[model samples]
Target: MNDAGPSSSHPRCDQIAVIGAGAWGTALAAAAARAGRNVRLYARRRQTADEINTTRRNDAYLGPLALPDEITAVTAMDDAVRGADAVLLVVPSSAIRETARDLENCVPRNVPVVICAKGVEPGSGLLLCDVVAEEMPDQTIAVLSGPTFADEVAADMPTSVCIASSPVPGEPVGEGTAAQLALALSAGSFRAYVSDDPVGVEIGGAMKNVIAIACGISRGAGFRSNMTAALITRGLAEMTMLATALGGRAETVAGLSGLGDLTLTCSSEQSRNLRFGLQLGAGTSRQEAFGGAPVIVEGVRNAVSVTDLARKHGLSLPICEAVRAIVHDHADIGTTLGDLWAQPLEFESNAHDTTFRHPDANMARERIEELIG
Candidate 1:
């Protein structure tokens, strides 16, 4: 055992911080505790904290798991975070940076911070890792993401996820943070794979939210599997472009973090984004769907971030842009559909032609400024 730095030699144990009271957080905290560690689950609301501590259940969100005795839920972030060797941030993507900044004052400086969130920032199209690094520069940060559905994972359903960190020389990632987290994350049927690519992991997780929304829309519109498959394919292309732009490994997108999660999330109605899109396909308004939900849907928010970033980077993501239009702009759905479906084909078929001369050079120029800056 060594210091608790990601590559630290400290003897890390089950002292973990779960910074989110949502279903995902509660379920993860349960998973870690069931792995034989003491977990501190943070709840934003005092009543929710009391409920978990008193009843050992988080029925409001994650209805599957009866929290283990070893897991303690608390409202105060400090109480939940204090002296923990590892911390899991399960907050939404839009709130990751802010949440980390707030948690920075409570947790140990050298503790490993693992981001369990999966989406990009709207104000700044930065990945979750970047957001974590911006706040906790010296802290060892990693990303844990995949196609995890809270209820399924809570019920000990078979699930696979990536636990990734940045590569460091002489860093023996064996039987340390990776092992501890793997143990915490693994259970009856869950399997965890370790990677040294933080950029790729976070990018895959975030970008997939955007893609899943399109997949949902395709399904919602009663489109056949043919269109759904095409959307997924094109969605992957968009994800690859965004990930590459953010310096993530290209191959990672095709791995569990990208292709795997995208497949699960986009196909299932259980996914919040997909469900929201289903409502859209059923002719419901975005405001109406958002208004009915008590929890935050990361994909809907991600639509704004992805579209804005693509515009800034001048990357063309017609699907995401269309989602934004329907969600935000008062654009007519039929006209919007026509605009997107009828987009003129470029003479060049190669997706790698990053610098294609668009018919609208001025618009492209603005988009480039939006993405590159």
Candidate 2:
């Protein structure tokens, strides 16, 4: 891949503030720096900031990979976003609301705040983008998601991601903000595709983690590739249903943020969600599956939120429900697996059905009506 520098056609974002110094955040900082943008990486801990500034490495999250000199580590949130043209909130999904709330007073209203985390909010069942919007109402919100691995991206390996921007209700859409941000981050090895479907992009990013756990459980339980393939296909259908119900385009679900991310997360052991599922399927307790460290397995938490969101739309996401049962409800894996296998057969596609077929059909009908109206 040719390292195409920032495009001259779009508005240039010369400085990017990446909130969080975890693997993904550090990797994004590297990518932005590689694209010739100065990067300020915000770390919660002074020690982390000092380590990265002193060594140009975030060994805690990114091993020995040396970051570009254009990247600087900052401990103060205000300092990080002070002059940043764009802010990439790469913190965990659970931290998004709080982080955005903190940034409300810091990030300039004109600067775009891109959400880089996945997973629905556990209690509100709100997408992370929505969570950010609620906190930073004046900021242009976008989402970046796809089949990306932090290690590979940090190493300058070829990667493609979708960056989607959508206007908040009652606000004018930023016609070229996604494209401009894409231009800022684009490189020979790092490609960014722009879209207007933050809803679809975020849905894909969040739900894929839940589906990955299901895939991991299936694989760990000795199911063949056939089972994994079935789960992935059906899981995607569920994703499309929820996304469209929430006003996202179906085509977006087929793009890099949706199917692309789903495939990568489900197939790779590098995904913490998949690894957690594997441990669960291999008879490890949920608490033990965490391996006693402060690792965030997004799917485990998202299972609850995804299922909740699906219920809100009156959609049936069987695989996600199964994961929720096993992970949260502590239902026996054997029983859950049996329950899944025993479900009655139905038409594979509901394209012709005017109404969704579910126990909460009325709710689904009303929600769809609200969305369309």
Candidate 3:
């Protein structure tokens, strides 16, 4: 019942519940609190909740960064979601289904649930949004994704993300709008743009992690910016292709969630996926590469999932496949990269052309540009 009406131009619900105590979740809670909204952050452990509440920090995740006073940490699930105007699920991709199921009992039926985790379900290969819909059929769902680093956003750095959600079914006049969801999450330094292409946003967010690993490997293997550029461009093509086949717009990949995120994650030392790939390139064992790491490098898991999803569509995602082979199959990084580069090349098409873009995206970038610009 907290759903925002479609006609509201500056739609934003005030009370927000964020599920998960990880770095990203804490960062978002801080952003909301900075926006002067009542925000509740859920942590599974009472100690974690206590630390965040009493110390105004998440020691394990944010590492002593002060949280805004308006943010409250909650240990009880019901207490977190009760009377919330919006809900953000920021857990890892593997936990999406379980988390959504738990929320079915607590979340109001119409409160928009924004998914911040990125990846495809391993065995089923379903996108996280689809998985959530299956678990919480009565709830409205949206996805938030872009070139975000948790610490940067928490520090109030200027950042932008795309929000994609379907309008409430069959409610022609008063649907739960994605713009409303975006407005609710946006703050002074944090901006949100609404989109209809959840598939594109989700795929872009998931695949970039895999590509960041590849970029890290190239850098660690003594390659320069030339190789990184090549890999990034080709990787975008692969991502655009796969996203298009799976009912997403190709131009969406060129937007913040795809191109923007790809550039940021691949080049930054702060990225866990890139760091993990650096270890792989330096000849470390998988266990040693991620040993005692606090954050989850999504690429390690997404590599396998992306490869499988590509194969299902009879497509060749060379970079993703190589990352998987190196990370999972123990294949030699040199041999994998060599083979990937040895493949025959094709002419580069304009990214906006119909031949290159997804068929489902009948709308133009001009429309989206108008919205954001």
Against the true structure, whose TM-score is highest?
2
What's the best-to-worst order under lDDT?
Answer: 2, 3, 1
Looking at candidate 3, what is the lDDT of residue 86? Answer: 89
TM-score, per-candidate, Cα-based: 0.86, 0.90, 0.88
How many angstroms is residue 135 displaced in model 1 relative to the true structure, after the best TM-score fit? 2.3
lDDT of 3 at 92: 94
Candidate 3 per-residue lDDT over residues 97-157, each given as its tens digit: 9999999887877788999999999988899999998999867888999999998888899
Q: Candidate 2 lDDT, tens digit per residue, 70-114?
A: 999988999899888999999999899999999999888889999
| Model 2 segments more than 4 A misplaced | 1-11, 167-175, 352-373
Return the clash pairs for model 3, or none: none
TM-score for predicted model 3 compared with the true structure: 0.88
lDDT of each: 0.76, 0.87, 0.84
Candidate 1 Cα outliers beyond 4 Å, as residue runs: 1-10, 175-180, 346-373
Candidate 2 global CA lDDT score: 0.87
